[model samples]
Target: MKLPVLSLLVLVASCATPGGDAPATPAEMAAQARTALVHVEQPDPGSPLLQVDTAAIADSVDDAKARALLAPLLSQIADLSLARTHVSVASADWLLQCQSLRRLDVRACSRVDDAFVRAIVALPQLEELILARTATTDASIDALLASASLKRVWMWKSAVTPAGLARLAARDGLLVDAGLRPSDSSAEVEPKPEFVNLLPMPGEPALDAALVPINVNCPVTGAPVDAKRTRTVNGRVVGFCCNNCPKTFDADPAKYEAALPKP
Candidate 1:
């Protein structure tokens, strides 16, 4: 897949102007680079940090290359931010190093998981976290509470379960947005599927016509697929929003044999 651009959502906002709360000289502003970080590299003497970053990122077409491009960024940056950058597990481990970090927002980053969530709890300075519309879950919230220093957590339309919310509510000091439910889209019009039994994971968007709804659910957590959001591959087959889902069914067709709809 083509890589997306990096933004400052999870990192410090841009340096302000020098004189009017800003500096007229670009060099002066750059001096405050401590406040934020860009994916561009900075080395001594006309170094090619920028060139390397761009070039490496361009190689994201190969997953391994994408991983290599993201490796340098983690530990060195004091204020690492890659909001909506669609980070993977490796990148999350890198972000754990921003010792001075105060805010981390991975909003709309689709591939988040328990490991990344657990990693962020170690950031003592993290006061505000935004995981809106991501794959966050109840376990993630539990980890967030363990941080002790966290004051607010904004996670709208995520997978924060009712049990998870109750667990945290018992402890005061959390400003949570964990009540939202997934698959709550009451179709403005009734759906047209003949027989439906499963659905996609929350917030994972449909891709091309082939993959209207992605199924990231595990066996224990699977939900019914909504026909309105699904497209037929063959009369007996369907597609997923991401390459990651459909793993189990692919492994043993016989295991899910009975679950398949009749042709």
Candidate 2:
């Protein structure tokens, strides 16, 4: 009798667990994609790009059941930050729960649309929006204007056009493109086989991450290396859209590195 009681106590004590919710780790979230399915596939804090969507998983089963499975997964995404990694939202509900979304920054969200607007409308101080390459059009300009708390709107090279820009100009305290938005010097320049042309910009537009552009003269074509598509360093031949530049640069990286801007 004493042995049986002692054994029961050991099993229960071995199963002791933390009271708080177990924050899903990158590995556990990746596993969620396996059995549950998702619309978009992007990993965070765990691995490289897994561009599969949970919606695709739902669609495989049937259309009617798709939205149901998506609701819960999307709700879990309370805060979305796409710096070193990108994530797929199952739906808009996931973003809405972020009680303190003071700044809703969306960049390179090519699939975004009006459905996501209501999620951000309640954000009291949405001062900055960098919609560099998203699908949100001038039509959604209404949502931008309706946000009584909005200050700065950055739709650099997205759906906003010249006519659309004029329509948005009428907003009371908002700053639109041309003057309000930072101008892209790259757009003004003609692509050529020379150093990237510059026009009086005080400083370069901040790069996305730890990438330093190294422009080296092509040893083979003698044109700028933008055309050279491939390169190799430390005994590895890498490919590039601007090809031949690599062979020349790989020949001597120290020389090219000397010319490159310090990261």
Candidate 3:
């Protein structure tokens, strides 16, 4: 996704005029970036699986005007409630730019720890924080308590203990959701079917579907057909008197494929 070019134009226009405050922290840099985001005329980049970071722009542009101009394109940012994005301690600094942020979902993020929790606590406007299935523990729960605006915190499947929950319960206004729930989208996904080989532990039999049976019989053992012991190969059903016969037949089906009754 491209950064706001118009903001850059504005930065260029402001260059000849001189002095302004330089950003110090990631959040400060992100604040400068927000101005650019506001002026961006292009389409939304959408939630990209791989994020393009703005570190290079912040590093290369030593000019205060140029750095201020480019901050919005370089910092990792989300304007609204950032949900379901892969956030961890490493990239959590990106959220510093989202001054309007209210909700954050870092579920299933293995790297989420006290550092990430502390970083977000500084956001004065943050409200809902979802850390289900993440690695957060009691170490950062106190930091969360510091946010006067926070209303709800979801901590299911995290490292928090009952004691931690008890401590949070003392707070007057906060609501915590500690019940077990799936971490991703609300949709229920069905499990895929599994197949097992019938042969004994040592070998895998490669069966050929080309052989057509002439009669109903366990071609490998010459035994009468048993409906319970059947397998389909190449769209045709083959049966055997015992379950094991199918394995032997499968080992070298061509030897017996012609022996069964043909279609």
- Among all candidates shown, the one with the greatest TM-score: 1
Name the weakest run of 10 consecutive residues (lDDT summed) in model 3.
48-57
- The order of the candidates by TM-score, greatest first, is 1, 3, 2
Instruction: Tell me the tens digit of each residue's lDDT in model 3 across 1-263.
Output: 24565555465445423364444454444444444443222224464211223333332322243334533443333323223334455554545655655565566556567788988877766788878877788997899888897889988888999889778767989988889445786687778963322323356444343332323567777766654466676677666778777788778878877886666
Over the stretch 55-157, how does candidate 2's per-residue lDDT look in tens digits?
3322232222333332223333323333111322333454454443344445555545555554566555555555555666777777777888776666766
Arranged by lDDT with the best first, the candidates are 3, 1, 2
Best by lDDT: 3
On the 0 to 100 scale, the lDDT of residue 44 in model 3 is 49
**Candidate 2, overall lDDT?**
0.47
Count backbone overlaps in model 2. Answer: 24
- The clash count for each model shown is 12, 24, 10
On lDDT, the stronger of 1 and 2 is 1
How many clashing pairs does model 1 include? 12
The TM-score values for the models, in the order shown, are 0.42, 0.37, 0.40
